[model samples]
Target: MKQPLLRYPKALVLLFTVLACLSLRTVTAQEIRIVTEELPPYNMTLNGQLTGMSTEVVQAVLKEIGVQASIQSMPWARAYDIALNAENVLIYSILRTPQRELLFKWVGPVAPTHWHLFAKPGSQIQLNSLDDARQYQTATVKQDAGEQYLQSKGFTVGKNLQPSNKYTYNYEKLKSGRVDLWIANELNALYLVRQAGDDPTETLVSALSLPDLGGDNGQNMAFSLKTPDALVERFRQGLQAIRSDGRYAAIAQKWL
Candidate 1:
């Protein structure tokens, strides 16, 4: 019994050391989930590849920081929800509105978004101001900034504010006279119309400019509040690195 005691202690120590190392590795390798939506010219899937202005900027930052994370594209509502509630989840091409200021950690003016209420070509909808749009039905994507902005202004869903799952669906709804207007980013509206095989100028017209939604604040890369501050700073510095190196400008020039 006394002779066996020495060997048993040695075996237990080796097992404990191995377990500690494995635990450390797991803790250090936390997953960073990146989520986005198919808002064209910003974030989209082309030929099954995730590429766009915001997507490129985000990818460049990840490379600058020597981090690798797959970007998943989904409906805006679902992506927003995951980023809202999940730990270490990152959302991009998002407008940093006052309503969302404290909800997450921030990075970048990845790009600016010009929000507008669009109408059918030659339609008699004239907007003297944002309030003028109240009487008409406007198509909006679910959980999008435009929809939220409208809701805050008393636009009711299933009434004057018609919410859909996709921006393209709103475009179709506008064209078919199902909705009097479509609220969307100007560049996105044009790209979507072009994708649908129509000239944007001929397909839709800007009815009103909603500057408050994203006029000057610009879009940003955001992380859930629970993500480490040090991790967020790494991304922030990486983003600045790209900007200083002209990679940010190159990506913007390519897509914008």
Candidate 2:
């Protein structure tokens, strides 16, 4: 019987090399599913297209890695759940908090966002701290970082915290005086107010800054824990490349 050629030392090495290359190619070729919400300036749908600061950054990273992905906009709760449970999932503009640090593989500081406690203009309510805000009804999108942050601080949903599936509804509740305070991203809150045909500067007043409520660090693109480390590292390198090449800055300028 003739010995198998692959069993030879040199042939075995070559076979292993080919197998490794094939494995890498297969991983790179796998499709990545991106999930985001309609939070303008970060991720949103415009003219039936998905485009925003974080979206552009994500696209650039994917392009750098030669991978293609389409961003899907859905309710925060659904998106969060999917990203948590599914493989090859990427969620952008996610606050990288201590509680979430170990849950997902992170790829960025894609954008900046400051949490604010917003009250209708001229409202007597004032929040100097998270505890102060707890005294009144606070509106937040369900499963959002803001909601999670507040809950972590002991604000119970359906009691002090008013959880809405839609962020627009939270803004509406604030504008209608149904909720005393709206815990939201400053830029997102302004965008929502402007989209609702109201001047944000006049319609909503920032009563307090909730810095580090979720995380003081900038927002990031996070991948599911089930995602391969090699794939996550590829994205991280791609993001770094964009940042060093001025593509990241240019994209952010377009939105900011």
Candidate 3:
């Protein structure tokens, strides 16, 4: 500048370029807000820490990508809403339904799940089909995938469906004979029954097993639509890498 500006030394220019690239990478690295609900064996609070089958898979995926994120446990509806409206948010153990296909970018099939209508042992509630279930009062979690699926099949809330804020409440309602059936996942229903101090095999019996409503795949990690495509792809690749490297299987074996 004092004289006529001259080109910087090659070494100095290279150093500056490297620094610029590092800064850009640091600034662009997405900060993920990972959220999940207290669905035991999948995502739950254990000794004040989040650890479950789906949680481990998500943690492994983030590790594969060198991302550090803290998983939070909340209500399923709250977690779902955050994942839907916030950038860089991820909700795990989400059922990948046809109605939810275009709502978010998916990163899994983290685990498989089956939906069933559960009833008290020896209860006269017989459900041979989805329509058969419509005649009895069913307990379901509000805004839950299972509830949505039942609603899609013509089940109406306040008439035949009793919506609760938590799955535990639904279970309680079933135990107290307040509801005819409870919509629950096969594994999760067992876990819940055990938590309620009852033998699952003797407490709950499957009345009807619904067809694969989760796009026939499984539960997945869903990211907000506003998240960067590159970031979503990175997570997807990270998941695939973990699956191929045997880490995913190890994690699944830990909980399942």
Among the numbered candidates, top lDDT falls to: 1
User: Which model, 2 or 3, shows the larger lDDT?
Assistant: 2
TM-score for each candidate, following the candidate numbering: 0.88, 0.91, 0.88
Candidate 1: segments with Cα more than 4 A from true spot:
1-29
lDDT of 1 by residue, 123-177 (tens): 9888999889999999999988888888888889988999998888998899899
Task: Give the local distance difference test score of model 1.
Answer: 0.86
Query: Is 1 or 3 the stronger prediction by lDDT?
Result: 1
Q: Clashing residue pairs, candidate 3?
A: none
Judge candidate 3 at residue 136 and give its lDDT: 92
Per-residue lDDT tens digits of candidate 2, residues 83-165? Answer: 99998899987888877889899987898888888999889886766788778999988888888888888989989999988
Candidate 2: which stretches are off by over 4 Å?
A: 1-17, 214-217
Where does candidate 1 have its weakest 10-residue lDDT segment? 21-30
lDDT of 3 by residue, 1-256 (tens): 3543345477678888798656535533546688889998888888998988888899888788887778889888888899989878888999998889999998778987888899998998777678888789999988789999888888899999999877788889999999999998887788888899999888889898876755335789888998777677878899999999999889878777
Candidate 1 local Cα displacement, residue 118, angstroms? 0.5
Q: Quick one: ranking by TM-score, best first?
A: 2, 3, 1
- Which candidate wins on TM-score? 2
All candidates in order of lDDT, best leading: 1, 2, 3
